[model samples]
Target: MLYSYAGHILVIDLTTGNIEKQELNEDYARQYVGGRGLGARYLYDLLKPGIDALSPDNILIMMTGPFTATGIYACQKYEWVTKSPLTNIYLCNNTGGSFGVRLKESGYDGIIIKGASNTPKYILIDGDNVDLQDASSVWGKKVSETQRAIYEMTKADTIVCTGSSADLPNPVKFAGVYDGHRCSGRGGLGAVFGSKNLKAIAVMKPNKKIEPKIYNPSGLKDELSELIKDIKKNEVTGEQLPKFGSIIWMDTTAQFGILPTRNYQDILTYEDIEGKIDTTGYGKKVVKSKELKAINCLDCPILSGHVVIPDHGEWAGKPTKGPEFETSWALGANLGIIDFGHIISANKECNEYGIDTISTGVAIGFAMECRQKGLINDDILEWGNSESVIKMIGKIANREGWLGDTLADGVRSASEKIGNGSNSFALHVKGLEVPAYDPRGVWGMALTYATSIRGACHLKSWTVAAENSKDYIPVSTEKKAKLVKDIQDLRSVMDSLIVCFFAGRAINKDWIVRLVNVVTDFDWTPEKLDEIGARIYDLERMISVREGITSKDDLLPHRIMEEPLNNGQWKGKKITKENMEIMLREYYKLRNWDENGIPKRSV
Candidate 1:
């Protein structure tokens, strides 16, 4: 008996229209655990080096962990693993929705999708029955429309689909896959879907649900009780997040002078735009509507998602999902716009079109900066132009006009195409756009962004909270290398467990190890878990290395390193090249990687 696992993997080859069930490898299950770690293990063994991410040979794995659908708090996430069409390297994007739970209940730990269908198709997993069905009827539809249509046709409990952005004549490289509002929102996995001529995946609720047999139900119950208490008592997971969603960080980021503005040309202070774009501002402008409310994933304690009805805009009175802190910053403050309604509308469009909000915002911000510098000759791509931002969203989604088509390829490729020193401020690390947090104010994030395997992702090693806490100095580079390395390893474990990142406050290493021990009957210590995390992260790095990534790729953008903040507490501060090198050297040494950022220990 496999405790806390479905004991099988569903393999689908779209080209051959074949479906096969392979027994889950018990040894791999124990070694890699599940989700990101397991997916990476499989991908490393199956994928050849230097294969085009959009080719039929590229594989996509949607994996659920042991804790998934086990009634564990915040264990609702599943990972989507593949070579990113945007970054051309290893990508592991995770999301929380009913889809993962339903997928698990359908009796498969994960689904490995390979080969390409000659025509549009959708995968239907209805209990024991699985088939590849023609998707010509819904190929060009938006995400929500395709989801609704698929649900209507099959009564699927959960459906994840790519929107029209992925189906465009020239698909947006930053396109994402959506399960309602929850998204695998980074790394252009949706473009990969479009390349395969795959539109959506629908999983129907099983007639007889497959629940993982817990090794110690009573012990698991006690641990869960403690976890719940921790969650309810902790200030972040308990009060702030639940009350303000992710927008609460707006106040913190602004107060700390880390609020990225005008494509990171400047950082905003609290006094600059306090009640306009901060938490209080969001509450007044966006959350005031009675139709707007906080929502949560399955068994999650923190209600971080907001469904809002904008008071004014084209989307007014329409109950659409609101933007998180990252999205708000990307679409609002980053572009020099503060109108909450416009930001909301922009976020809604991005979601509907199945594009990454972060990448889209940064791409537009890059264009706006380019226009200011006379590199781009377009008047519409100007800073603080909310209407223009909306217009560009449509253009980018459809690959409309020159500006739209160029920006659709992401800032890195866009800068290369429209060169005039634009690459200096592209604001990306390893081809992926940096998230809301400006590493200038939080020095630890400098290392975080530079070394993250999937590119400038905050979740991989979120040093912000720790660096922002009272115990640590936020601007100092001292000890940041160790801090980043430790956090990265821990996050690798969390992603493998498929636990929600927001729950990190309550669920520490001790708590996680306890949960795993009870559920899977594994006698894992905190040290052991840390080792496994390091191993998983190393394997992922190896995959990237095999694809030609070197120490040169592990770098911060020129803007982040060269340009200093002009205002606020962090004035004249920038993550210098010297600082980045010191951190990188220390990080590489910690990971047992060579000077070239290649793993020294063979997997």
Candidate 2:
């Protein structure tokens, strides 16, 4: 009998309105663990390569790990896995809100949704009773409005939904949850929902917590206490993160010259904009003005989320969840915008419109660059133009006009269509827009961006912290590969446990293994758990390969690899082709991939 698992995998076919429950295979759980690992394994087994990402054949899997609802710190998150319409490759987007815990407490390990519906619909899951109800009334509403509608109708506290943006003719690549703040906001998964005619999912509040039958409850309790203590003692998790949130990253990344600025043109020159763009400035201008409220996910001690009420200027009374590190970099330095209020307003707009801020910001930055170069004759798009940025956010989400349609597809596709030399400056890898970190400053991020299966992503393996550490040798590619691989494996484990990445910094490997063992009654060593991470990574890589990713696809954006930093700490530095090739060789060797980055058939 399973101890930590729900012992069931619920499958829903929206086309036929049919729901089926299948037993959770214990052997499968033993091999892949749960959450990301299990989700990837299932995708590999069930999904055919080259299926249209937005088609009915493409499936959406919502999964939770063993630690979810087990009182494990920051385990309230859940993953949404599907073929990405944005990248046309495997994608996994996770969120922390009330959804994962409520889902697990509803007596199901995860949800596998398949097939498109003929009409607009929403899934209402109340314990064993599941219904696909018509969503015609809520169909074209914004994210927050739709969520509120669901809550009023079902009295459900957790709702994951798409906005009218997803229903665009070209469709956007983001979606939101609950308060229109927390999001599964990448890879066009929201567009996939629109394609399937799925508007929202409502999981009713569970009457009682689904208590897992743990083998050693007392021992588990003791270990959890120790883990909490460690988390509290850590400077990042206990203090700065809770107080400043991820906003603190802006200062560190900027100091290191890794922050993407002016559309990847230069990392420095942002000193002038610091007062209006940096975290310190935001705290002084906004946080102190009776407007900042630190928020957190359920069971998270860090309180990494914040809601800022701006009551002083253009955004005189706007409350928004975040202009978090990535979003801030995208909108602030990348586009050269310095208005803090404008950034906050844009954040709220993205949430309501249901678009990924990173992608939206990056895409707009690309358009601004295109305008500067005279590639596009548009007066509205220019560097640091906050008004234009705000206008474009709505246009892109709705796919309103020629510019909207061009950018709604993101930087990659937009560049392809625009084609003046715009593609040269289009900063994307594997068709997904690059995030905040400028690779020329921190080299591990070079490898991280290149090899990420989900495209240019930082979350897949965030190694900037280590690369910036005192012990790290900045120029050496020798240890870079090993560092990236280790972090990826470690993050894989954390994702399965479904804990916040920040929490994992304090939660050690030994404690993680202990928690899993007590919960599942499985004798898993640290090495064994690490192996699962490796296995999951390889599986995702293989899936991407099946969808046609190769060493050729593992590349940094042109500007990042070729352009030297015009100024800052990394003034003369650039990631040359030779440097990147050397690192890729080492990374491929470590992963047991051939020179072409293809996994060998013999394993």
Q: Give lDDT per model, in order.
A: 0.88, 0.81
Can you write out model 2's per-residue Cα lDDT over 53-85, one digit (the tens) per residue? Answer: 888999888888888888888777888788998
**All models, RMSD in angstroms:** 1.6, 2.1
Write the residue-wise lDDT of candidate 1 on 1-603 in tens digits.
679998999999999999999999888888888999999999998888999998899999999999998989989889989999899999999887778889888899999999999999999999889999899999999987898899999998888899999987567999999876788889899999999999999998899998888999999898888889999899989998877788988888887778989999888888876888777777765444443322357656787776667665566778776679999999999999987888888998898899999999999999999889888788777889998999999999999989899999899999999987889999898999999999999999999998898999999998877898877898887889899999999999899987888888889898898999999877899999989999999999999999999999998999889889887788899888888888889888888999999999877
Per-model TM-score versus the true fold? 0.98, 0.96
The residue pairs in collision within model 1 are: none
TM for candidate 2 is 0.96
TM-score of 1: 0.98
Where does model 2 exceed 4 Å of error?
174-180, 285-295, 311-316, 601-603
